[model samples]
Target chain A: MNLYRAHVLICGGAGCLSSGCKAVLDKFNTELKAHNLQDEINVVETGCIGTCDLGPVMVVYPEGIFYQKVAPEDVTEIIEEHLIKGRYVTRLLYERPASGEQIPFYNEINFFRKQQRIALRNVGLINPEVIEEYIAQDGYLALGKVLSTYTPEQVIQVLKDSGLRGRGGAGFPTGLKWEFTKNAPGDQKYVICNADEGDPGAFMDRSVLEGDPHSVIEAMTIAGYAVGANQGYIYVRAEYPLAVQRLEDAIKKAHEFGMLGENIFGTGFSFDLEIRVGAGAFVCGEETALLASIEGKRGEPRPKPPFPASQGLWGKPTLINNVETFANIPVIINRGADWFKQIGTEKSKGTKVFALAGKVNNTGLVEVPMGTTLREVIFELGGGIPNHKRFKAAQTGGPSGGCLTEKDLDQPMDYESLVAAGSMMGSGGLIVMDEDNCMVDVARFFLEFTQDESCGKCTPCRVGTKRMLEILTKITQGKGEEKDLELLEELATSIKATALCGLGQSAPNPVLSTIRNFRDEYLAHIREKRCPAKVCRALLQYSISSELCKGCGLCARNCPENAISGEPKKPYTIDQEKCIKCGNCLDKCPFNAITLK
Target chain B: MAKANCPLPTSNLSEILDKYKQSPGSLLEILREAQAINGYLSREVLQLIAEELGIPESKVYGVATFYSLFKTTPTGQYIIRICESAPCHIRGAQDVLATIEKTLGIKPGETTPDGKFSLEFTSCLGLCGVAPAMMINDQVFGNLTGDRVREIINSF
Candidate 1:
C-alpha cells in the first residue's frame, strides 16, 4: 500500500457535480502531474461536504484547508502555492460573512461548526467508489460485532434504548417496528431500506447513499439479522442515478468481501441485498405504496393496522426503515445506544439532516441536533436570507408541513416542537421564504404539487384536495370572494380528519398553516383583490412610469404579443387586454420604468 | 405498428429479459433500461418486453404509462429537464425557464423543429441549494443564467 503526503478531497456529490466539480477535479489531475507532484500528492473525489453554496469546494488534508468556489483556472495556484510552497491559499479559504475572517479548517467554519455529522461522517472524508477506504474507517465493524456477539433481540434492545425514530417524515419508532417484524409469525420475513425520497426540496437520503453507501448496506444487514430475514431490498428513486450507481457498487464490493451473500465471518447468518428503482411516484415514499411498486403495481397507499411489520412484500412480514434511519443503525451499535440517546431531544434522538435552500445566503445540506432552533439554522448557520431580504417564514416538511413564522423562530426544530408550531418534520426540507414571497402563492404552489401527485385512491385526498386547491388558485388569481377563506378552512379541516393515508391527511397543512400564520396576506388577496408581495400575476397591473420611461421601444419589440405601444421618446402604455402577463416586457425594459402595482 | 426499425439489437433485449426473468418486481428497471436503449417506449417494444418477461402486454403498457420517466412519444436528440419546484421557483427558475423557451422556440412540453432539443419541467432534480437548475440528459447544470443556457444548448 502507498501513502500520500497530501490528499486533496474534491466534492463529487450531485450538488457539486452540477456546479462544475468535475471540471475542477480534472484540472487538479492535470496540474498536479504538471508540477510533478502526482505521485506524492493524491486527489480523491469524494461525496458532498454539505456547503453547496461554495462549490466547487475542496479541502486539502494535512493542513485541512477548506477552499471554496474553486475553478479550473485556479488549480495551478493551489498546486504551486499551497502544495508546493507549503503556504495556504488565503484567497480561496472560506471567509465568514459576519466577521470576514478567513477560516482554513472545515471544523472552524460556522456552517460546519454546529453540525454533528453521524450519517455524513464519511461522506467527504473517504472515496465511496473504493470499499477499502470505507473498511479502513471501521465501516463493517458494527455488522461483524452484531453477528458475532449479539442476538436479534439484543440488537433490537439497543435500538430501543437509543430512541431512534424514522427520519423519513413520520417519526415512527424504529426499534419497536423491528421488534414487531421479528415477533410476527412468518417463515419469510424481509428487511427493506426506504430510499424513495420524494419530498421535492429534500436530498438528504441521496447524499447519504452517495457519500456513505456502505453505512446503509451495513445497517440493512444488521436490520436483516434483527428482523430474522435473509433478503433485503433497497427501494431507491430512478431520478438519483448517481446514488443508485454508488449503492450498486457498494453492494457488489460487500459481496466480494464476504460482508454480504450467504455466510459472513464464519457465521451461519446469510443475507443478500438488491436495489429496486422507484418509478417517479411521490406516494411510494409511503412504505405500503413502496411495497406495491416493488410487487410491480401502481404506487398507491393502502390502509394500515396490517402495517408493513405485520404483512408486507407479497403478504410476508417485512421490516422497513427510511434511508437516514438505517444509516444511523451501524453507528448506534458501534458507539453504543447511550451515546446516541444523549445527542438529540428526549423523543427525537440524534441529528436530522436538512436540505437547506431558498432565499438564504448559505444554501446546502445541514445536520443539526434535533433540538436546534430555527433562528440558529437560518441566521447563524445559513448566514441569513440573501440580498438583505427580511425573513417572512420558513416552510418545513414540504406540502405536508406548515409555515413557521417569526413567533416560531425560537422553537426547537424537533418532531414534537415543529408539530406544535403547526408543522411536522417531513424529511427535513427547510425552505426559507423572505418578505418578497406571497403566503397565498406559496400555499397555491405546494397545493399544485400535492394535487398533481395525489394517487386518487381515497375520496378526501382526491376530491377534497382538489376543492381546496381550486379555492387557493382562485384566491391567487384575484377572483376570490370573502366567503372563500371560510370555505378553505372548512375543506382543509375535513380533509385532515377524513383522509385515508398520511399524504391525504397532511395535504391541507400548507393551506391551513398559511391561513393560521399569515391570514393578513390571504385577506389582502381576497378582500383587497391585491397580492401584497406582487407575486400573483392576476393581481399585478403593469404600467410605465411617465417620468422614468425612455420610450426605447425595447419592451414593445420583445413582447411576444406586442402588448406595449408608444411613439419614440414618449412613455409607452401597456395594452392589458392583449398582454398575456408573461412578464416579457418587464424583462426587456432597459430603463427599469415598468412597475407592477 | 410504427416499429419499423429496432432501437436495440434483438439479442441484447433477450439478454436483458433473461437477466430479470427470476425477479418479477424488476418491471421498473426493465422499463428504465428499455427507454434508455430506445428513445421512447413504443408500443411494439412494450409488447416485445411483455412477451420476453411473460407478463401481459396490458400490464407492461400500464407500468410504462405509470412512470413520468418513461416517455410514450419519441423525444428529441437532447432532453432538457428544467426543475420547477418551490425552491427553484423562489430563486428565478421562472426567468431561466422563460429564457430557455425563448431560445429554443418551444414550450415546456414541446420539441424543437429539427428534433435537436426537447424542454420539459421536472418536479425536482435534488439540486435545490443551487436553485434554478436543469438536467440535460444525465448531466445536471445549476445556477442557470440566460448566457449559460445559450452556451449549453449551442454546444449540443
Candidate 2:
C-alpha cells in the first residue's frame, strides 16, 4: 500500500494508442525520473479517458487537472512546471471547442461533466493491467461480498431491484434473465460474458475490457456464483487484440489473487474463466449463434425457442451477458440496488456507454443516463456537428439500429423511447451525420454491412437482403425506377418478419427508418436520379462555373479522364460524356470553378 | 481449456489438435491457430484438423469457409483490411481505399505481385472514432486520407 502526492493517468485505450499515447507515456516516465519526481508523482497508463477525439489525454490527481493531445515534448514542460513547481500548464489544458476557454479540471469540462460514468467509473482512473490498482479502486469487493454474504436468489433479487436491462441491445431485464438461468434445472451451468462487440462504430466494450477488465471478471464471477456455474467464457473479437490481451492478463491476475478459480474468498464457491476469440463473424453477437461459435461450429444463428436460459451450451443452462451488462453487475452489488435504481428512468436503470463518432465535432465514448436526450449527448457533449455543419441525423445501434432524425433530438435515449422513435437501444454506437451525408447512402451503407455479414443459414437474410442491396446499389448508380422504392419497402417488411435471428429481423431497421424519415431523398434518387448531397458518384456531374473559372487549365491537366478542355484566360468546359466522375479535376482545380450536382 | 499451454498455438498444428482433441466444439479455435501457423488454412491442414478432431472433412472445410477471418486461399504477408462498414463509409473510406489500390497497384482482394500486400475490405474494426480506418495485419491505421494511405503503403 503506497500513497502518492499526485498520480498522472495517461489514456492507453485503443483510440489513444492510435493517436500515439505510447510515446507520450514513455516520455512521462523518462522525464519524471529525470526530474527526480518519479516516486512522488505516479505516472499510470490507464484505459480510455472518454474524450476519444482528443487522444493522448491525461488527468492528474489530487487536483484531477485534465490535459489533451499531450505530446512527448509537452511531457517535460508538464513535469517541470505543473508536477514539480505546482503550476497549471494552461497550454495543454482542454480548451472549449467554441469559446476557447481552457478547463483545467476533468470534471469541469463539458464532455466529462455531462457524462454519468457507472460502467466507466475506473476506466481512465486506474491501470487495467494491474490487479492491485483495481482492488484499490474497490473493483472486486462485490465478488467477495456476494460470495460471503448473499444467497443466489437474494443476488437475483438485487438485480431485479436495480432494473438493469441488457446493454447488448434487446433491453431484457437483467434480474429476470439471471433468475431464469438460476431457476433452470441444471447443476453444470455456465456463465458467459458476451464481449463479441460486432457493431462497427462501437468500441465501448473494447474500451471497458482494455480499461477495466477486472470489473467484468468480477461481475462474471458473481454471475457464476448466483447461477451455480463453475466455468465462464468471454467471447472477444479477433479484431481487438488489445482487449483480448488485457482480459487474459486480468483473468490470470484474478486467479493469482484467489478472486477466480476454486473456493474464491474461502467460500465454498469455485469458478474458472476462458477467452473464446470470435473469427470475424458479426452474426456471432447473437447469444445462440455465439454459443454455437464457441462450440467450434459455424457462427450462424439457430431459431430461438430454447432461449439460452434453459438450453444453452451443451444442453445446460447458461447465463450469457454482454461486456457492458457484466461491467454493471459489480457496481450494482457494491453500491446496492436502491442506489442504482435512483440514477435512471423506471424501466432503464443506470448509464449507457456510447462510442460517439462520425460527423460530430467531438467523437468519443459517452455514457449518459437513460433519460438523457439525444440533443444533449450530441450538441452539449459532442460539441455539435464538425465545421459548423447542419446536423442531419445521428445513427445508433450500427446495422441493427436505425437512423434518428432532428424530430427525435429531444427524445430520451431509453429502450422504449428509441424503439418508438424507429431505433432500438443497440450496443450504443452513436454516429452523427451532417447535411453533407446522403440519407439514401447511409441506409445503403448499413444494408450492405448486414447483407455481407449474413450467415446464409437463413433464407430471408441471405437472398432478401441481397435483393434490397441490389436495388439500393441501382439507386446509387443512378439506375433506380419508381417500382424499386416499393420493392425495397416490400423486401424490408418481409425480411423483418421472416428473418430467423435478431440480425436479419433488425437488418432492415436502417433502411426502413431512413425511408420513413427521408422518403424525399429516396424519391430524388429514384425519380430524378439526383443525389441531394451529391454523394452518389454516378449521379454527379461536375461543371465549370463561367464566372469563377479563370481558364487555369488545372482541371484539364489534372483530369485523369481528359474530360476538361479550355483556352487560356477563358472559362473552361467539362466534356460530360468523357468524364468518369472520379472527382480528380475537383481536387486539383485551383480556381474552385467545379461544382458537382 | 488447453489455452494455457499455447495461447495462440501458432507454431505447431498438431499441438493445437491434441490440445482440443476430439472436443465437441473446438473447430473454430483449431482452424484459427492452424491459419496463424500456416498463414492460410491449406487443404491438407483442413483435412488434418478434421481427422484429428474426428469431425468430417466437409464439416471442417465448411467451418473454414464460413468465417471471414479463416482464409482458404493464400494471401500476401500483409493483409490490409479496410473497413467498409457505415461509420467508415461516411468518413471517406472509399477515397482512402482507392489511394491504397493506386499506390499498391492492386485492387481489393488482389495480392501484390511481390507478395507484400493483399488488399481487402472488412466489416468493422470498431475504431469509428478514427473513421476511415484500416488494419494492416495486426497494426491499426486510422483517420486516413488519400495522402496518409499513400504514405503508409509506400512505407510498407
Which one is best on lDDT? 1
Query: What lDDT score goes with residue A120 in model 2?
Result: 91
lDDT per residue as tens, model 1, A1-597: 668999999999888998899999999998888888889999999988888878999999888899999999899999999999988879998877766788889888788998998888888889999999998888999999999999999999999999999999999898999999999998999999999888878889999999999999999999999989999999998788899999999999999999998898779899999999986788888888899999888788899979888899999999999988888889999999999999989888999998889989889898888999999999988988877789999999988999999999999889999999999899999999998999999999998888888888899999998998999999999899889989999999999999888888998999999999999999999989999998998889888899999989998988889888999999999998888787877888888999888
lDDT of 2 by residue, A116-160 (tens): 888998898889999998998887899888988899999999999
Return the lDDT, model 2, position A327: 90
Q: DockQ for all models, in order?
A: 0.73, 0.69
lDDT of 1 by residue, B16-35 (tens): 77888797688877777777
- The 10 consecutive residues of candidate 2 chain A with the worst lDDT sum are A48-57
The DockQ assigned to candidate 1 is 0.73
Model 2 - which docking category?
medium
i-RMS values of the candidates, in order?
A: 1.1, 1.1
lDDT score, candidate 1, position A502: 86
